[model samples]
Target: MTDLNARHAIVTGGGSGIGLAIARSLAGAGADVTITGRTLSRLEEAAAGDPRLHPLAMDVTDESSVADGIAGAVAARGPMAICVANAGVAEGRNLLKTDLTFWRHIMATNLDGAFLTIRESLRSMAALDYGRVIAVSSIAGVRGLKGAPAYSASKHGVIGLIRALSEDFLGKPVTFNAICPAYVDTDIVTRNVNAIRDRAGVTDEEALQMMVSQNRHKRLIDASEVGAAALWLCDPASGSVNGQTIEIAGGQAA
Candidate 1:
């Protein structure tokens, strides 16, 4: 049996991309997973006929939605032993051209949403005293991504939250950590590629290369790589690995 046998987990944004991959990994490891997103159809699609993967429609940006959605998941699957706050928006805009609405939108989904998810999940996790809180930050969180001031700042804020929570929960059974990934081949990246192509008047290949070149490996990362990192963070022996940012940018020096 896997370490996650009979464990209950909640993965936000699990309708697609990295979130879905992580949910699959957790379920494969014997977890009873609740996959959440804003679209019920997408969430149901991700469930993919898997009995262990339950679909929950949730908008992380809405406090009431987060609260009720998590409550319902816990009521059905029991207390969430693992919470992966992976719901976020990835967009780039120069500081000069960015507006308050743009900045707040990113923060609402990336930073504030993560804070809400972690906060609500902890209400149940604290009772069990055993939990793993993983936030899907970006390499931008560590350093900074060019042309994306708002995104970088929001990601940095996520890492800050994780660090603070880790300190607050010192020596406790719960651990808080953030995974900083570079350009992974997800739908988000595809959208960014299109945006870049349109903005820069560059070819599709060139736009993709622009992102791929940022990684040390000069290749797009896989969602499973991030999922595996998350899995490692939840390992029984990883109790002492807290408050750290694990960068999966193909060995990028961050």
Candidate 2:
């Protein structure tokens, strides 16, 4: 296990699913992990009395909230050495039915949220000698997913943001990367299964299969699998693995 004692890390949307998995992995490695979400109760429940996992209420779509929330976390736990921008909303809508409100909502929570989280974390990370910025992107980011134009575009934007930041801080100690996973077994999938059932007029099991079939292995990925990948990226030996999109898609993504 990589020792991260005394290090401070922040994970947005850490109340559940992939974010919580990543937070647990970091905390297990001895890092002081702060988990943020819009719901305080959910965050606290997820923390489950773990002293290392601190729960914080933060609305990522709001810039002031993100800035102030991150500033307070830094103030309490020292500089942020690891930042995981994992907060996101996943919904699929046909282009003809997609309203501007829906599109902007996705962009706000996915693209803009990652931008704000990374920007605020960088304020302290840039001053330090070692830092890691990890954004949770999706397989849709690398390829277009039918019926989800807005979501796909927003995730693509996240990859672009991370890649550009990697270039901007080239030769610096801080490294930026995005984790792209395919159909992870999370609450997001369960909700989307219901949505798919309604949208496609299929049984719940059939709708779930629709997603399971998308992965090359024909199975839903475990959240812990993605968590392990993130921990690897934060390892001391991963300093050279910057500006990359790691696809945990069970096999060749293409």
Candidate 3:
């Protein structure tokens, strides 16, 4: 049996993309996973035909929703031993054109959402004395992304939060860490490409190439690559690997 056999995990934004991949990986490792998203239908569809994957409707931007939703999931499946705060928003806006609304929205989802998810998950994890808290940050977190100042700042905030929590819980059974990736092959990247094309009047190929070029390898990263990194963090030997940012940017030093 896998180390995660019979473990209970909570994955935010697990209905699709990198989040979904992580959920599936945990489930495959024998975890009973609860997947959350803003759209119940999408969550349901993603959970469809998989008994190990449970669907929960949640809007990470809403504190009340996160509290109630996570509480309900824990009540049903037991305390969450693994929490993946993978829900985030990525948008590229220059500082000159960015408004408060856009900045707040990004912060609320990427930074605040992670704070709430980790804070609430710790409640259950503390009781159990064993847990893993993993946040999906980005390459933007470690280095500045050329047109995405807000995104980079929010991601950097995520790593900061994780580092603080890790220090607070030093020597405890629970470990907190963040995974930073660059240009992963997800719908978010596709949307960003489209947005770039629209904003800069660039062709589709040009927009896509722009993102690929940002990566050290000059290619889109696979979602499974991140999933495997998450799996490693859950390993028994990884207990000491806390408060660190694991970067998957094709060898870019962060």
- TM for every model, in the order presented, reads 0.98, 0.99, 0.97
* Ranked candidates, highest lDDT first: 2, 1, 3
Model 3: per-residue Cα lDDT over 1-254, one tens digit each: 34798789999999999999999999999899999999999999999988999999998999999999999999999998999999998888889999999999999999999999988888888887678999999988998788889999999999999999999999999899999999999999899889999988999999999988888888899999999999999887799999999999998653
Q: How does candidate 1 score on lDDT?
A: 0.93
Q: Which stretches of candidate 1 lie over 4 Å from their true place?
A: none
Off-target runs (Cα >4 Å) in candidate 3 are none
TM-score of 2: 0.99
lDDT of each: 0.93, 0.95, 0.92
Total backbone collisions for each predicted model: 0, 0, 0
**Highest lDDT against the true fold, candidate:** 2
lDDT of 1 by residue, 1-254 (tens): 34898789999999899999898888888899999898999899889888889999999999999999999988988998999999999999999999999999999999999999999999999988579999999999999999999999999999999999999999889999999999999999899889999999999999999999999899999999998888888887888999999999998554
lDDT of 3 at 122: 83
Clashing pairs in 1: none
Residue 111 error, candidate 2, Å: 0.3
Number of the top candidate by TM-score?
2
